[model samples]
Target: MGVKVTGTVAAGWETVRAEFEAVVAAQPHSPEAQLAVRHHGRTVVDLWAGEDTDGETLSGVFSITKGAAHLVVALLVQDGVLEPDRPVVSYWPEFTGHGKERLTVRDLLAHRSGLINTPEGFTIEELADDAFIAARLASAEPYWEPGTAYGYHAFVIGALTGEVVRRATGRSIREIYEERVRAPYGLDLYMGLPSEAQERWKPVLEALPTPAQLEIQAAAGPMPELLPVAFNWHTDPPMDLVAYANHPLVKAQGPASAGGVGTAAGIAGMYAAAIGEVDGRPALLKPETVAEFAKLHTPGLDRVVSEPDHFGLGFERQPAVGPEAFGHCGAAGANGFADPVTGIAYGYTRRRFGFPGGPAPENLPLTAAVLKVARASS
Candidate 1:
């Protein structure tokens, strides 16, 4: 008979019972979610909830994939393949066009390259075509002076950094991630999720009290204009935003900033690997290298989100909405991050779509739940 397989952390299960329930209850139909926490290479919490499309339960995290993508770059740095301070134009010369010659790798990672929003008319599919997108960015002028100001690159960071990875290693970003990171640690995450694994994805239901509703809700509060129209980029018809997200172009192409798919378990495990070293295997980054990446480069009002977005090399720092976490969040409410201080890494994936600037704290609930587990474990 085949041996039964179980996760290593499932043994000493002291679940964050109430907090998890509160988070799950607050959201819409978020099927098949999982959360994992580890401290000093020891598992404290490994839990799963809900189901995927096939009724085989799982959770699908969205932009947290950016954090995973960042790890790939971290590995490159650790292996001496890439340097953060080098000019991006050195690797992809075409990037030197349009006043971007001076933009450094660190600028690209921190979303300060000034290539935000892809201009008005460019198709989202261009995001998948690195060369085409690079050319577009090359010819296009920066929305703001590169490195002088900050803006969330939104979708552009994925293409820009992914190109650097492709040019540096002569390997597809996905392949590099698989061989260097995922396979090494045995984590189930992907920049390009397989079609067969589509069965594992949950159908995200739209969250209630839409952005319009939130606007109304905020009218009663001190921050009435806090929910602005700028945040509603996902609603634009030209973008066909939802289709753009699920498109093969978006999936197969590595957008280190945004396009990624995986579970909370996978994401948390990957981050744990970053800090803990997987199964005694050598980490992709040295302790100092990780520390370097964690240094906050830009911390202030974001040009895109129009909020105080704290960014490290390629990770978001302690967001006002969550703990001292470092990871990326998605447009339609998905989040993944890790807290090295506490050895807590988490991924929360949900299918619910909502207008930006809504009442839903997006991934905050999951983050809060993870913090609870981490504190208990500590």
Candidate 2:
């Protein structure tokens, strides 16, 4: 039997529903997933599939938590509480030496710090606590000269930037996000999934790769030296990302780097709130601030991932969405972002890891369909 996709689409967006259904049908396995879109601060599409899943069901959103983490940073910068140009050591004293005294806050935000991980990797428990990660990273040496190369700080950027937030303010990034953003907007997304909300959360399913995909993986052979380090593979048990997110500690702490859980509406609502008026409130970010945070700061080959990637102030530029779009995608297929050009906020989550990871390929056509309707409606 086919999994039933159930949800509603606003008038003039029926094509989106059709497209979403087609996408689900094309999946190799049933994807227990949810998708949401908000245009001009109003929800236009909300859909989900698979057993026991709905528009409000929650799942691990992995690295999309970075978007929430950086949103708080952008707010502090907008308020003049944090200066992007200042050296990171200016804010966190211990984050100095080892030739890193000159690394600016912008450098950290742009993934140019070269401080991917400590010589010894973090245990799952240690990785769940940003404070623990930050403390260790304080004295850790950069794999490359600070600000000289770019690599995804994979598991530590949140702790790195979160530490700066703590020093500049007297609070954690989670606290700031809870008070200034999530609470006021009542967004379904959470930096820390509370105990009471546990019932709504679901575990992510592992990717069931096809025979051809297995052949491709077998051909690739041995992992690169940097890939394992970037992903903290030195731990005794290493780190199983799927298991890590499902762990209770991660749900409770919701480490800003990866431990976020929420519905598609929750994340899409966040982007909507950031870029447009929502529920009688003004946009969370000013147009100029959004532009600055979304603007590309690092371009060209990423040393760790070895791909041509772009990053802004802690935000990943979604070139596939639009020139100025900004957001982050999780190791699972989840993603959330705002496209200023179309005044669209989008979020997608799946309870299964998509093949090959990092922003599921389906997002391309899904986004195109939304844009098509958005332009027609406008």
Candidate 3:
């Protein structure tokens, strides 16, 4: 292969390395991908295969940003800095204006707040600033009545939750992230990119679907029509996900919802730190905190994603077949989650957008491969 697979896997995980190579080899164009898995607090797999990319290249990890942002919430919850069941207006008084005063912090976390989008769709400039997003959304009535339904907040959940963090702690989530999680652990994931790390950023490539691809996607189950509304696509001009992420300003501001930039190792290491000891540090979340955060919060239909799955306090209970994993998947095929049972913290990144969006189809085999190795090792 022209683009070589580089990085190390622990001795017992050679098959994972082989699978990584096969994934890269099967791609028609240059596939830029990074995969990392930390097993039992040790990074047993670190590999990257693609052109113009090495292990350090940071990719825009769309909604996976939610996992990173919410981990901060989990930390504060562990510390009793905020209460999940408290009415959000208790933390930020302005939350009262839109009939949202009665909604609990847990309601927002479970995607039941109903403030999915606004009448005036956000420009990329507006989405770049979490405060502006929170402000605009603060007074907008929920698309559905609060607590009646759960939907993926999609573009604005983090901003919604981050605003609560700001009110409770008097610091933006980004700042708290720097002091508590990112800086302490030296994570390459950046909610806000500093000057020094700009050179390592890789702009994501948008993939246009072919007719065959479109047909296959339609066959898989029609893409949710309401997704546009959740993403603020009803206005005259709509958001282009690739353009939103690639814009220089967007990366700089690092909006809490979707502006996160990271490497696979960075994402993998983050989940590992949250649930398992890393380096010399203990896990950030206590066992009780983990249990509370991972418990099924959305058990009904997810109106935004149009799937019936469980959402747990902002983290996602991925699917039925995989190991009981919890974390967020992003728009451009980035998937990162912690399998608490297997002690596997996994992250995968791709610079190209996939047709069906969210996590790529390849993730199934990749996850299976990782879980198989992890279980065997355990």
Collision pairs in model 3: none
Report the Cα lDDT for candidate 1.
0.63
- In candidate 1, position 103 carries an lDDT of 89
Q: Write the per-residue lDDT of candidate 1 for residues 181-229, one digit (tens) a residue.
A: 8877767677766676666654344444546668776676543221222
Per-residue lDDT tens digits of candidate 3, residues 1-378?
Answer: 366999999999998998888877766555588999999789999999877778999878888888889999999988889899999999988886556888999999999999888877888888898999899888787888888889988889989999999999999888888888898889888897888998899899978566888787777875576688888777678788899889887899888888999999999989999888898899988878888888788877898887786698989886733425678888888889987788889899988787657887777888888889888767
For candidate 3, what is the total of clashing residue pairs?
0
lDDT of model 2 at residue 234?
72
Of candidate 1, the 10-residue stretch with the lowest lDDT total is 223-232
lDDT of each: 0.63, 0.89, 0.86
Better candidate number, 1 or 2, judged by lDDT: 2
Number of the candidate with higher TM-score, 1 or 2: 2
Candidate 2 lDDT tens digits, 97-209? 77889999999999998889987788888889999999988988889999988988888899999999999998999999999899898888898898778888888888888
lDDT of 3 at 90: 92
Residue 106 CA error for candidate 3 (Å)?
0.4
The positional error of residue 248 in candidate 2, measured at the CA in angstroms, is 0.6
Q: Rank the candidates by lDDT, best first.
A: 2, 3, 1
